[model samples]
Target: MLIDGLQCGHFNRGVFEELRAGAVSCVTITGGFWQGCIESLDAITRWRDLARENADLVVLVRDAEDIDRARAEGKTAIIVGFQNTNLFDSRIRFVELFQDLGVRVVQLTYNNQNEYGGSCYEPEDSGLSRAGKVMVREMNEHGILIDLSHVGELTSQQVIEHSDKPVAITHANPASVIPHKRNKTDKTLALLKERRGIIGCASYRNICAPEHAESAEKWAEIVARTVDLVGIDHVGIGTDRSHGHTLADMHWMRMGRWTREIDYGAGSPENPGTTAPLDWFTEVRHIGRIPGALGNIGFSPDEVEAICFGNWRRVYGEVFPGGK
Candidate 1:
């Protein structure tokens, strides 16, 4: 099980235990997204407490060495990451502190303009702000992997060109494969490759643009298209799964001006009617269903492995070595 990116807080104790007991190999756990500096730090403190209690099942991985060691010891490696840069709060030095706490990946913004850059949902994507350039440089200097998944196209391109190190669009689809603002265009995919970046294909229903409520099979089709455009080597998995939450949570996410206006309507229906309640544990199972779906796309085990975990491991090794 290639544990793609997800929020650490989404899982309850039971779900966490189940995942640890499952065949999961590793996971990039998100700690920050739409959080301010103080709140982000507090979240990490909570993670620290969880890590202490779940030491046997969870090992906080700071670098490549830790990942290898965890695999050898039959433990799940947790790659720390931030889904957004709201924690930065216009302070570049915060990057060093988060890096010290084992954060390896960070997206510049969530769904609106920030000190760093414009979000994909932003109406006017003027590009990365002046502060954003400094933040990019700071991230590069500290060796933290930058993510462009929720960033606007112009801002994404600018960051790619500005950063000395390779960045990742941790979770996105191919625009040609599924046309959506969240999906990356063919041109952006090519540019990322040119800059030595990777694209983690997401399994989110919204990103895949399911017709009504489709099966996980829809996600596999999106991945197949991503692999076609960027090839197996440049592609990887980042499920963007928000388990332990429901359509209400989805509505909460849409409350953001950018996400609300663009993704969801002005307000979620007062009553969601009778939509099936979400099962957090099923998220992992849904991702595991992808390989079978890929078989329909003519992908072999080798290609599947690359998309599942190998590519991410390779990139993680390059970005963080010696577990630091």
Candidate 2:
């Protein structure tokens, strides 16, 4: 049951074929970021069309059972997600609407602050707002897993304390390991584990140590350190793989209509482009090799299974709840 907790692939028949080749049982793919309701709906429609066209390779996942079904049928399960709450703005009712549309996970904030709360890139961390609290409750009631991968520290902590259900840091690493703002601190990770939450170790290079960006062994070390910090039950994989995307797509993600100028995230003036791909995992199919890497890093077979998929399955089951 290999699962990727987060990815932003441009899914088509070829990409779906790659997922099959990788033996991925399930994957959570982004549906929108900084998109209004109409655009978000259009994105969802496109995803649905893709799944329909590639039904032989993938199926839309509405709950944890769908993940198991996909694996049993040898097809990859697709969980549509959003990296921002921009789709609905202040309209809390859209939570249930999107859930009905097959969106299973959503991040509170993206790279910048919004009505929900501050983001990792924001200067001051304004904790979750009143509207944010309402939104969180709505999502809980509706069975949508809250994600804090790009949210700021203060807001992330408040969300962890406020939400009745356990949340997820879907695609971020430990700040102590890489010292990136996008990564979580040791204190936050401890709090997440205390709440029985899960953290998906992201394979994105910008949030990882520079020397380790291309080394599977070093990356596995990062995963081992996270497992040591928060037991294997709370750890999983989120490759953040953007296969089939180009530099233009990267620019759109970073500067999503917020700034007129190009915002090179984790990059500088000299190298104003997308971050380098991981040497070991330049494509989605390469994710299949991660289990071996984890095993080589002293993880037992059971532990490897947990990190690869079982842990995500547990969290998704708790949040999705028998498909509601």
Candidate 3:
């Protein structure tokens, strides 16, 4: 069964339809980018209703076994997730509250310094804070998977070193592969490999290819290269999508509540908007097309299977024990 590691979609029947068309058995959709606690709760509520509306097609995944169960039934297991830590910002206790609400993954920081730590985009990254350390331990105790996708290099290193369990870089590529800020460093990848952690090759247009090749072949090449660098068990799919979002919605991901000025992530002030995700993956069904490309690129069936969804399954079992 195919699984998308992360996506920010329009969230409706149309999205679920795309997911099924892609033959996705499990997925982790964004519940927040930079939303506060109340907004995040509202986002979860909205998505809960939407998932329930399409109950026949998908179910909210709260455990490792839910993924297999959904796939067995020919349905997609939707894992509600977060991309930033500000929802619980200063309140360490809120991590459990959000976990109770079905948030399986939480990126420690977004694009700048937060209560947790510095972001990759920051010019002077101070790394993880005192509060950030507490948050990590708290999340560990509660089994919330820590995501370091948008976190600073130093901070990402710290989290990987600090967490007793394996963490996930749910969506990000190797910076050597693509020089984007969102991409990670060799040091971080080394630590990740040491921890037997997992990473998702982000399919966001700018991060994947500056020229926007956006083909299944191009994406397959990226994944293969990443696997070569970090080993097979650590890579998966996290095709960041904006299939049905508006310009404003895209802008919101770039500029959250903290920024009064327009923050053009992976874009410029002149070109203040990020491009579409991937040309080949405009429809969710396009994810099903990746395995064949992998096969073409000399990825063995087992390796391809690991990249497709197996690694993520292993991560789920490692991070979320006993249904979390």
For model 3, the stretches where C-alpha displacement exceeds 4 angstroms are 210-214
Q: Please list the residue runs of candidate 2 whose C-alpha ends up more than 4 Å from where it truly belongs after superposition.
A: 321-324
User: What is the C-alpha local distance difference test score of each model?
Assistant: 0.71, 0.88, 0.84
Assess the local accuracy of residue 34 in candidate 3 as a C-alpha lDDT between 0 and 100.
78
Model 2 earns a TM-score of 0.97
Q: List the residue pairs that clash in candidate 2.
A: none
In terms of lDDT, the best-performing candidate is 2
Task: Per model, state how many residue pairs clash.
Answer: 0, 0, 1
TM-score of each: 0.86, 0.97, 0.96
Tens digits of lDDT, candidate 3, 1-324:
677788876777877887888888888888888788898889989988987888999999888899999999999999888889877856888988888888888899988788789999999888878988999999988878898988999999999999988898888889998888889998899899999888888777777775435578877888988888999888998877656787888778888777688778877776666476577876667878888888888998998889988999988888885852
Worst 10 residues of 3 by lDDT: 206-215
Error of 2 at 157 (Å): 0.6
Put down candidate 1 lDDT per residue, 1-324, tens digits, no spaces. 564744434654565565556545677777766677898888778777877887887788777777767767776777777778877777778888888877788888877778778878778887988998999988887768889988989999999899887789887778787778888888889888887788987755555554413654555676777777877778887766665666555554555333434345212245332223123225444455666666766888888777776777777766663432
Q: Name the top TM-score candidate.
A: 2
Q: How far is candidate 1 from the true structure (C-alpha RMSD, Å)?
A: 3.5
For candidate 2, write residues 1-324 as lDDT tens digits.
Answer: 588889995778888888889889999999977888999999999998989998999999988899988999999999999999987756888888989998899999999988889899888999999989998999999899999999999999999988998899999899988898899998889889988899999888878876666667778888998988998889998888887778888888889888998787756687687776788877768888888888887999999999998999999998984652
